[model samples]
Structures are given as C-alpha cells and as structure tokens.
Target: MTMVLCIGHPERSPVLPLHPGARYYAAPSPVGTPGGDGTRGRPWDLATALAGGRGGSMVQPGDTIWLLGGVYPGRFDGTLTGTSAAPIVVRQYPGERATIDGNLHVHGAHTVYWGFEITQSNPVPNANDALETYGPDCKFINLVVHDAGKQGMSFWEDEGTSELYGSIFYNNGTHENFDHGVYAASEGGEKWIVDNIVFDNLAYGIHVYVGSRHPFLSNVHVRGNTAFNTGAISRDGFQNANLLIGGDVRTEHMSADSNLLYFPGTTGRNLRLGMPRGDNRDILVRGNYVAGGAVTLLMNGWAQAEVVDNEFIGAGTIVDLTARGGSIVAHAWHGNTYVRDPGARAWRYEGAAYELATWQKITGLGNTGATGTTPMTPRVFVRPNKYEPGRATIIVYNWGHQPTVSADVSSAIHAGTRYELRNVQALLGPPVLSGTYGGGAIEIPMAGVDPPRPVGRTGPTPALARTGPVFDVFILNRTK
Candidate 1:
C-alpha cells in the first residue's frame, strides 16, 4: 500500500521498475560466486536480498534494500514498512560488509534498518541483543554489534528513539546470562543516546530499565564511551548489580560523564543505583577515572544521587552505602580521591573501621632555621603519638625576607629515629630549595604505633604523622 524503492544511488541507477509496493530480491555474493550484482558486478544473497522466498523472506512497503561488499551469512525474517511520512531504509554502502542473522522484526510504520554484523555462537534467547528499535522514530547509525547470544543491543518499547554516532558493543561474553552491552526500554518520551564503545562484557556495560517496560525513556546521554571489563552479575540469575539501573520514575534526565571505567568485577556497581525498584531521582556521576575494583561506588537503591570528581584507583569501598535502607534520601559526597589499596579490604563503614581524614592528612611541616626568611609554615594535626619514639619540631621564620630568602622544611619521621646531622652546613641561606624538585632532605620512616581505630567509634584520632613542608612553603600570594 506504498511505493518508492531505490538501491545504491550516487547519481541514478534505477533499472528494475515493477511498482506496486515495489519488491526487487537479489543479494548475491556467495554460491559459485561469479560477479554478484548488488552493484559493479554480482552482489546478492543477504537472504535473497532481505528475505524473499523460503530460504527466508519478508519485506514490503517501499522497500529500498542495498547491501554488498562481502560476508552475508543467513537468517532474517522481514517487515520494514514506512509511515512517518515515508521511512524505511536498510543501509550499507560505505565500503559495505553486511551481515545479519535471525530475529529482527519491525511493524506498523516500520523502519527496521541495517548496518550489519550480528554474530551469535549458540545460546540464542535474546540473540545477545544484536539490534532493536520497536519503531517509533527508529534509528541506528554506523553499527557493529559483536559476540552475542545475550546482550549487545536490545531496545523495544519505543516512542521516537534515536541512536546516532559510530556504535560498537563488543565481546558480550556470556556463559549463561549476564548480557548487557547496551539496552534501553523506553516507555514513550524516548531518547536513548549511547555514544558507544563498550567492551569485554558479560554484564552491565550499559543497561537501563524504565519500569513497566519502556515508559518512553526520557533523554539519557552516556558520553565519550569506553566501559572496560563490565560487571558480570548473575552466576545463576537473579541480578546482583553491574550497572543495572531502573527508570528514574519514568525518565527525565540521566547522565554519565567522560567515560572510562576500568577492571570492574563483583557482578556490578561501577555505577549502579535503583533498578526497577522505582523512584530514582536525578543521577549525575562526574569526571570518571576508576581502576580495578571491589565496590568503587554503589549507593544501592538510589533516590537522589551525586558523587563528584572521581579518581579511585584499586578500589575496596570507595563508597558502598549498605543499600541505603529505609528508603534512601538525598545523597552527596564531594571531591573523590580514594587511593588507598594497601592489600585491599580494610575499609568498612558498617561493622566499623573507616578512616578518611582527607585520606590521612600530611599538612606541610617546616623548619627553616637559616633565615632563608623564616617560613616554617607548620599546620600539623596530630593524634598518633603512643610514643614508641615520637618527636615534634617546628620553627620557621621570615621576619621580612632573609639572607637570600631560602626556605625548605619537611616532616614525617619515626622508625627508630636517627637523622644524626648535628649540623650539615647551611644555616638557612645556602639551598633555596633543592632535593631537585620533590624537595630536599626528606625522610619518612614511621612506627609510632596506635593508628587503627574505627571499629566502634572511640573517635578523636587522626594524625599519627604529618609534619609539614609540602613544597617548602614560600609565600608570594601577598596578603601579609
């Protein structure tokens, strides 16, 4: 009940005129192979150019098919109608290498497309989500969905969907079921924007469920992609967390900034919050830079989230709020930098033992006794002095500039102490700041003991050692 079919057009190459809902079946490239005709010479057999008779066929409604370069496997039942004022385009012309297999159906104002490459190695329940858009305003550009039998790209419950920009969801590793390299079930508002490049998956590389199955998902933008080693949650199914988040009540806005999540394991939680449990407020995770893992950040069951300035290397509880029980409310933790991986597993906020005084302070220690201008800027915050042998010294001066204005002072010493230098020359005006650049004469060998208290809140403790000189305090900010 519609018409207008044209394949391969740069200027004009229309030589198969048979109107009436137009249908031209011929996609040859394999089978005795001798100059296939999809273009230049002999090119047809993408299931008889998009299904057309027993071998597997189905496609009508101004059908415009064109795929020919090489590699065209089999299986593809069709239905690509056009109604949004005429919309149904199956593509592959920029150095074509088309390939599609089984399961791909779009109806009504149909707009099922093709950019090819969906390989499955057994285990075909969801066909590893090799491409789906339940036709609303359907869209897919520069596609490459790899290794599937589970999840690589699945979208249904459409309502004006759009996915532009080169996409590539790889590995999709699944033994049974973890699948999720890119999944979106919009309820209606629709706008699942994934600037793709997901890798090594078994689960949670990009997954979003908007309750009641596709509530037209609102605008969701996951920028500059690269989610490494995705979370494979589900050894036996039931979902445990691997970046699986449910609709924030019905989508309005959800974001993930400057992507790059490395080596994540433990089923999930590189960035997971509220899944199908409903009521998820605005989500905004900023400046990503994660490494290895064991709970980098999991505010499970969210209801108001915002964890900022990220950079947590080799994680182990960078933030794992125990399920936020009791209907979690508004959460906010600023400036993240948890680089404490001393053989892992030490931080636990629930059973106690959690220390983060800005990650154990070391506020610039000083001792400028040679009048480089008296600037022994000391700001020591102490609390670890059980004295197996503890020592403290502070004295810096800048009475008004000195004999050559030399200044240098650094502190943190404890291992059986012995800097034995009754006087190594230079009473202040000889070395204006040397030790190259990391500063000079610095020695930190601590033992002073008693620095492990967080099991039951004995409180008031932090500063076992931090004796100043963070770059030999030299004032010039002028504010005397």
Candidate 2:
C-alpha cells in the first residue's frame, strides 16, 4: 500500500546546523524552546523547523536547518521543497552529533541531508526502516544506518535521481530474508550507489531488483563499494549475494565496477547480473575484486555486456559467462585474473566446463585472461565515515589467525586526538580500547575477543566460529 510520489513545496528551504547560510536551529525534548523564534538563543522544536517556519520566519530555499546535538525521537515526514539550484540543506550542528531514533521519510526534492545517525530507539512492532527517500534529485551523505527493521533504505523508483554515497549499512534487517540493505529501483534519471560499505545484512546488500513489480530498472551505477558477508550474519546457507543488479523484467544502462566482495566461509558471492528470467542491456561489470565466490551471471538476457579487468579468487565457479543458460552477448571480456583450485569450476560456456585454454578456444573471449593460485590476501578493510570526520568502520580479516593486529587509524584520526575503538558486534558495550592518536596504528585484539552476538527476541546467544580467516568489524571514534 504505497501512494504516488509528489515533489512540491512552498518556500522550499532548509538551513544548516553548522555552516553560515540563513541557519535555523531545532532541538528536542529537554532542550526545546517556548514560543521559539528560529534563533540560536531560542531554537525551535524539531517539528516546527520541519514544517517550514514558526509564525513570521519561514525556512526558504538555499536555507539550512541545523539539528541540535541530541536524540530526536519519533517518526518524521519532511515535505520541504527546494529549487534545482538553491536546494534545501539539513545538517548537524557544528561538533554535535544528531541521532534520529525512529523512522524518517523525506518527500521533498532538491534536498541535501548530511551527517546523522539513524536507528530504532524503541520497539517498532511493524518493523519499518528509519530512512526512505521518495524525493527525486536528492543527496544522502554520510548516514550510519544499523540495527533497523526491514529494509535499510527504501530508495523507491519514484526517486528519479538520487545518490547514496559514503554511507555505512550493516546489521539491518530482521530474520526475514525479504529485507535488504538498499531495496531500490529506477525508472528515470540515475540512482547512484557509490563508495559505501555494506555488510552482514539479512538479505542482499545492494539489491537493485524489483522482479516483475516494476516496468524496468535503469541508470544505476554502483561503483567503488566494499560489501562482505552480505547475508551471512543473521541467517544460514549464505542467504544472499553481496551485490545484485537485476530484476524479473527489463534493466538497462547499469554498471557495478571497482567494488570489493568478500565472503570467506563458503561461496562468497559478489556481483550478480540480471535475475532469473529478465532482460538487460548496456550492462557493465568491471574492475571488481571478488574473493571466496564469483561474479555470477544468471537467468536473463544480457543483450550486451562489458566485463573487464576483474580479479576472481575461489575454488568454485569463479566466472560464469554463459549466464546460467540464459541469453548473453559478452562483447568485451579481457584482463580477468582467475585464482582458483587447479581443477575447479573456472570457466563455463554453452553449458560445459572448460579451462582457460579451452574457454578461449570455444568462446573466443577472455583471450588475455590469466590464471594463478595467489588468492586475495587477507587484511583489514577500512572505510572512513566521510561526513563524520573522525569515525570509521573497519573489518579485520584474520586469515592466519592472528591474535591481535595493529589497525591504522591515522587516516581517520590525526595526531593529538583521543580515539575510542569498539567491536561492532558488542557495539552497545564499552570500547575495546581508548587512547590519544599519535598517527600510529591501533592494536585490535581479534581471536581472543569474542563478543556474543546480539539478537532481538530473547534466546541463547548463537554460537559462531572463531577459527581461521575470522573477520571482525570495529568502529573507531574520535572524541570531540
């Protein structure tokens, strides 16, 4: 039950919480104002600011709305609109952090939202996410979305153009496999998923699939992303792939390139093109580094494909070009490096298995391909929380069972800054260690520190393997 999207607003304005540009301030609960006047001394409540203005002062385009540093409880729906050039801006106040402990739905166009932490603060029986972008041509920058219910961000196709950039989505979704990190679709303009870190969600990490529901999905470019153990946290059987870009209908002009996909336990599936029984065109899957799994192309019509310079490391079907008995025209396939077991499923074409030599002979593709046994070496994968200057999400890939390793935080935190490190699994608990940064690496204790996994319903903490190739996630916070 969804309503048609409407992108219109009357003065269409917002003001930053930090920068200088017709700024307005809003606080919650105990820090609220009485008969407020949108001033620093007497800030309005969160609701008044979102509703355009109070009494005389109205939030206008190119304006900024500054959210005071505190938790804003309850679900909110913003209907502010802005012009194409003078879009509304909503930001956190100077050094203070703003936390929206409930759902947020933005129905305005040309809005720029920045630097906020979104999660559920209470029991949401129906279980909806805290983010939904129905507005077209908007930007979501540096959002930390975790431990929510259902989908992480419902970027509907109605949002003709939008960008999900420099964000972190993990530990989302319930036990239900229907949820996803980014449940998205597109019909007009571009839906860009760029430079993000998504992991351990219940279902697919970047699910750009609509099945037969939508007419078609197009113009989505997923680039420079790092997704691992996408569907491995909550469910078993390696529930879903790290990235998926297909539907049960028609999809065109999309690409998934320069991304890293890693799942070590079993088949660590990475990027998949075209769902079973769909049609795709002008697709590009290139420059991706995949480990433990492969770049699987399945059940669809790939009218044209450009797969180049991708490195695959695994013992199973590292590269399935035939599209699992679907229709595909792989025009350009070169510079692909395959590091697999000697006699494993390396290449399959026209419903048959073949080595590098035979695969080139029959298909005449992958002529410049090379095969070796050097897999992607395990190490720490770090992604900085770009909008929140001194914060980062790290993944410690302990391939050799190292008890502890020094994790570099110099990039996230410079010298003379105090930092706090915590295991994301035990995120609600105390920090693992806290000290001032000296432009050096932070020693992370891996194998010895096993935090019992947290769950919603009360039950025995499920047992997780802590053996070879153990991967643990951590958060580094720079104390203000």
Candidate 3:
C-alpha cells in the first residue's frame, strides 16, 4: 500500500516503514474535535487516540500512533504490550512538533517512543520523572526531556534490555528532591546509553543505582555522551556528580568510554564508579575527557576497573583509591593524562596523599609518568560480523594528539589467513596497510593526519590532547 510521507523537519520526525497488518492512528490536538475519527483528515485528541475508543481501535502490538504538532497534557502511559519483532511505535508526525507538558510511564515491553519534547509546565512539588520506563526491550530515541521536578528520565526496576539513544536530558531535579538527569536501576539487563547530552541537574548527570534486588547488571554500555554543569544545587550536604555508579549490586562487562564530562559546580567526583556495597568487575573507563571537579575519579569499595587512555584535567585529585576498602582484586591505571593544578596531589591511596611518582612506586602501577601526561596508546577491538559470517569489524581509536602509527593485530587474526580490507579509505582518508601477517604479532600501518589545533591557542592546551580520530576497519577473509 502506498503512503503519503510528510517532510519538513526531518530530525524531529522521519518516515517510518509501515509494518504489515499494523494499523495507524493520528492525534492532532487543539485542532481536531473529540468526536472525530483518528484519520489523517479528521484526527482525534491525545487521550482518545491513546485510549483507543470511539475515534480509534484499541492500541495493539505492531501498531503505530502518530502525534501531530500540539501541546498534549496528562501522562502517556504504555499499557499495550508488543513483541521483539513487531514493537508498538509512538512517534511524532513528520514535519511537525509534538510537546508533552506532562509525564510518561512505560509499563509494556518491546515499545519505542521517539522524537517528542517532554517538559513540565506546572512545576509540581516532588514531581515524578518526565519519562519513566519499567519495561523490557523498550527504546527511547531522539527525544528531549527537560525541566522536570525530579529526574528527566528513568529506567527503574526493569529486568529487560532497554536503550536510550540520541536524546537530551537537561535541567532536571530540585534542591529538595535531589534528582538526577538520567536515573537507571535495573535488576539484570543490558542497557545502551549512547550519543546523549545531559547537563544542569541538581544531582548527577547520569546515575546507575542498582540495588540489592538484582543479582547483576551486565553489558551496560555508556558511550559517546556529553555531560556538563552538573550538581549545581546541594541537598542536605550531599552534592551530586557528573556520573555516579552506586548501589548494593554487581556489574559485569560495564564500559563507559569516549564520553566528555566537564564543568562540575560542586566538589563531588566527576566520575564515581562504585559504592560502598557494590561489586563492579571487569569495568572499563577509557578514552574519556573529564575536567573541573575536585576528584576526577573515585573508586569506592568492591571495584576492579581499568582507567585507561583518558584525560583528567584541572582536578584537585585526579584519582582517589583510598575508599576502595581492600576489595579491589585487580585494577589498572594506564596511559591516562592528568593536568592538575601545581602542588595538588595526583592521587590518594589508603588515606595518604601521594604524588604520581610516589603512588607509582608503591603500587608498581601508572608507569607512564609522574605528571600523568603519557603518549597516546592505540586501542583495538575486533568482533566477527553477525550478518556476514566470514568477515570481521575492527575498531581502532587513537587516544592522543598525534596520529596512530601502527596497531597490533596478533590476537584478532590467525596465521596464514589472507584477508582484504574494505572501507579503509573512507575512514582514514587512504589505505595505509603494510607488512605480511604471519600472525604471532603483526603491525598494520595506519597513517592519518592529526587533527588541527584551535586557532588562537598560544601554547599546548589540554583540550587538544583529549580527542583524536577513530577508524573502523572492515575485513573479509579471502582465503576461503
């Protein structure tokens, strides 16, 4: 069946492919009467369209609800359930804007809500989240949630995988309420929080507070987001942070990488990775640029994490390992650059302030330098392609000011295997692969131009070393 697609503000709304046998309903409030059917020509109100009575059929799995441009009030509760293959989609109408001056509650599984603006108009005392989800496999994408009384968005008490992508959560929480920008607490599920911006909250910018209700939170990935100006307000002498991972729970394979966190108003830690009761294992915090906090990173009790290839600039204490409580079995601090104020200690270990030199000598860690400005270290990860069986994708991130010269690929490939690189020129400007792969340890040349510095900087700035180019290498086996 042919459909008429509208186009104006493409990012606010995009044309979605119609699922087979799925029904469509439209809600154009402030213009459409309540008695009309939910058709494109004669749309219904938000309540009638969502409740699905006189103007529309009941919302079912694989259904699509199109919200036209207008201000909608009341909570948009997700009471309808859907499957993984065919999810219930609630999206804005193309070329128009939809604003919800209320809250949202998602109680159903496998649902998606995209491209809307959620804000608080009345400003109630102790107000709930602008968007709160307790369902599994639910996704919130490209939405703006701001100025809430409490958290901007939350994923609480969920046991299923959820995702939040390309969204903005800002200006949330009150002084008394002490809320966060994004508060996530799941029993056990994977969460992908990527490409978002969170700022200007009373508490943390992003918080993962998993309590003792769950055994573990696994595969939690927080990547490529930006957070700034957090914890400006205090609550009962407890200030917030840029990011906080706390609770009486366990975590596995949790990674926070390539994020930009800065400008903390309080003296709280910029990146607090653990709590007094939680056990975090195999956690990786890498390639992040953090600045303007009293403590850059605080590893509390029962945590074994790797702080690698990150730049921590202008902090009182770059790393604090005093509160670890002797529960850290394995921890590594490698290739991290710290630009602190002079005479400020770089680290605090076991209740004693130590410079980088003293700490490195005692623990045999952080061998890079005393000032913590180390050369760029190359990081690579390879995984087999799910769609194409005989191929793999290589991710190479250069965490320095200079371009990466070569990358070791011994662990990724086998000996005597002939492979061809695809999409090499598109990523790094040109193909620069060299040398034969007998594969005990082979190096691949990756010569790319370094990024140009800012125009008016006199000397070397810390911001210049915080970012570099990243390349993706797609490889196909030619031997078979």
Candidate 4:
C-alpha cells in the first residue's frame, strides 16, 4: 500500500510542533570539537554547542541547535536540559543529512533530538549501546541508529518516561545475544516505544528483558511497531523472538497492541510476553499479527490479563496462554485468530492440548475468532522520504513466504522514476532487485537475505535458527 502518513523523511517526522522561544544556534563544525561561536556562519562544534558553548553559554531551554550536514566522528555527550513544555532541540540542518559515526549519550532531561544518523562506525570498548539515555521526558524522534557492539539504543530506567519513536534500527549487536534493536527498561513511569520499524538486528527486536543486576521493571507501553527477521542472521546463528517483554524480574501491567511481527523462516516466535523466571502481575496483548511463532505468555500465568483480537500463526501451538495452576483472572481472550496446518496441535492451555472448538468452549475465548489454514499474504507499505523524494523506507511482510511481493507507489512518486530496492541487510551490496517504476505495483525480491552472525549475548537463542523465505526490510532509492 502507498504510504499516506509516513510519506515524508523518516528522520523529520511525527512532524515536530512549533517550539516557542525566538533563539537559534548552529554547529557547522567540520569535526566534533569545541571551537567557533554559535552563529550560522561560524557555528560552534557539536561538543561545544551541546556543552552550552565556549565563552559562556548560548543554548537555552527552547533554542534550536542545527548540526550542518556532514559526518561528525567521535563520542558526543549532551547535557542540555529543558522542561516538558519546552525542551532543547538538537537536529540536522534543514535539507542536509548528518551522520554520527560514534556514540551519543543523552545525560540531561526534557530534550527533543531530531533527524540524524547515529551509528557505531567506531565501536566502543565492550560493545556498549550506540545511543544511551539517562534523562526523563525526552523524545528521540525520527532518527536512524545502527552498527553497535551492543543494543542500538539503551532506553535506560534511570529517569524513565523517555520515548524512542519514528526511528529505524538494524545490523546492531555484533556482540551477540546480549543486545537488541532496542533495550528498554523502566522502574516506573510510562515509556513510550511507538511507530518505529525495528528489524534484522543480531538479536531480538524491542527487547524489555532485564537481568539480576536490576530485575524490577514497570509501566512500559510497546505499541504501533513492526519487528521481523530477528536473530535469523547471527554470528552465533541464533533466531530470537521479534518482540519480547519481561524477564527474570517482577513485571508490572504492560500492553503490546497494534503491532506487526513476522519471523518467516526462523524458529523465532513472533512475540513473547514475560519470561519463565518473572512473575507477571498483569498484561494485555491485543490487536497484533504474528507469523511463524507462537504467542507464548510464559511464567506463572494466573494474572489479570486480556489477550484479544490477535492473530497467532505458527506451524504448531500457535497460541500458548502460559496458563499455570488456575484460570487467568479478569481475562478476555477472544477475537484472536489461530492458524496452523489442519490436525496440528493448535493451542495449549494449562499444559493441556485442545482443538479450537474445545478450547473456545472450555475457556470461552476465540468464540468470535476463527482458525485459518493459510497465513497472511505478502504486502508492502511504502513510506516516502520527505527530504529527498527519491528516497523511501519500504516495509514488507512476506508471511506467505513468497519469493516476490508487489507494491504500488503511484501516490509517493510519478512514473519513469528509476528505482532500486536493496535489502537493509546488505546496503553496501548491489540492489536485490531494481526496475523503473510505472506508478504501479512493483515486485520486491525476497529470498536468502537476513541478519548478520555474532555471539556475545547471554540470553538463549533458538536451538536452530530456522531458514526459509528471507527478506523482511529494505531501502528503496531512485537510481540514475
């Protein structure tokens, strides 16, 4: 389908509202350093500007700091703080792209960072996160971060309530099972992880699992996200879930809704809620689509919950409530579609196998939902890049495992637009398939493309990384 809303540059989106205050600063540094005054012509370096300038201090709470287009290599620590109503703004120069080839640490609170490419071109000592957050009420929007030794972003639990929205993550966690596309944690307050595309990471995507160091997390809302092809390509050959939350710690009531998950060929489950060691108090899993994995809710599952209107499609045991000793209290497990080969064990409740009709009657769930023999057909969503109309991020779901899927881009670009599609997994490699767009459905080649291989994580990878029909994410740009 043609992208209607996300038709603009992925970096500049959720289109920022007008910030008050009549001040602006510039960082036109050729290198990230501490020189130059804060002026458009003589802009200070990124480090200087973020440190509040040289002579005294030039950055205010609501002022805008523009980093002129170019590569800024090195580590950057930002200490600019702002209120919830008015946060400090650090973004790329208009119409120009900036690439940070190191690490970014947000040490202050209430700031809005926009439009930039943050990567780990220079890996840290221990394969740490490319982006680390320490402040609260901050918004890291419309950014692209990848190539980390560990996670792409460490949305820490220090202050909590930070947002990682409208961003893209891939090719990270060269360190192995330890990292993910997003490593989000929260002890309290609401953490918003919304409308982002995370795929092809070395490990799981949008992971909320924690360890013994700090085992208690609460109030995390993961919504409007798409994750696929996780752990398929790895240094250690481990295929993990597309999306997972909860671990060995105590997890509070959380929700996973309106998301898309697919693990086409891998043994990875599309989505997993809670781990075996953790005791989940309450949970809600609704309106999600899963393929090639079961929606398993692990641990002691006699919790207050609602698992409704979701699709769980896998070869066997499409849905496992993780039911423990007793029935789930205050539960609503209906309107959820289950798909499997006929006669395959389709569901498990309290460790007992049951057919769809029997399970529905016994638990009074899936009464409105139906069992399906087929998986979701392949479909594509084209998101136009606002800055350069020739560039766009295309999201493809190849649930049926078709070698090719087609999409119409007439709304985003016109005819005669010579375009090439390259799987994000191999951006440096030649395009997987390319053709001139005639303003109609164009086929995307999806076969033998996936995440990289690595081994450093402590979490368990799939016993065997399943391999099947492969492509999940791609970048579409105009070709000469």
lDDT of each: 0.43, 0.69, 0.62, 0.69
What is the C-alpha lDDT profile of model 1 across 1-480, one tens digit per residue? 111111111221121213434333334345313223333344455544444323333444555556554455444534444554444556665445655653344433445364556655443444445555565655554466666666667766455545433355655545444467777665554554433455445556677765554343555655434454453222432133334445646544566654545443333356555554565556676655444456655544555666576655443555554333443336454666566543344344333434454222211111101111112332211111111112212122122222222222222233323332110011112322222223323322111112111111122322221111221111110010
* Displacement of the residue 330 alpha carbon in candidate 2, Å: 4.1
User: Model 2 off-target regions past 4 Å?
Assistant: 1-19, 33-35, 55-57, 94-97, 121-124, 157-160, 233-237, 293-300, 323-330, 376-398, 403-455, 458-469, 472-480
List candidate 4 segments past 4 Å from native.
Answer: 1-33, 122-126, 157-160, 212-215, 294-302, 361-368, 380-394, 399-471, 474-480
- For all predictions, the C-alpha RMSD in Å is 26.6, 7.5, 12.7, 5.1
Q: How close is candidate 3 to the true structure, as a TM-score?
A: 0.68
**What range of 10 consecutive residues in model 4 has the weakest lDDT sum?**
2-11
Q: What is the lDDT of residue 231 in candidate 4?
A: 70
Q: What stretches of model 1 exceed 4 Å from their correct place?
A: 1-44, 47-70, 73-77, 80-130, 135-144, 147-152, 158-180, 186-198, 201-204, 209-228, 231-242, 250-271, 275-278, 281-297, 302-315, 322-480
lDDT of 4 by residue, 37-66 (tens): 677766777778777777536777777788
Per-residue accuracy of model 3 over 1-480 as CA lDDT, tens digit each = 111111111122222334734455555466655676666777767666655535344666777778888888777766556677777787888667888888888777777788788877754553778888887887787787877777899876356677787576755765343588898776676787765667556578998777787676667778766665565433332245688766677766777887767653236678887776776666788877676577887767535677788878654777777435554447777788777643566677766788777766665564743354432564454433321233343444434423432433444456666655533213223334433456643344344333222122122322211112433232333334
Against the true structure, candidate 4 has what lDDT? 0.69
Query: All candidates' TM-scores?
Result: 0.29, 0.81, 0.68, 0.80
Against the correct fold, how does model 2 do in TM-score?
0.81
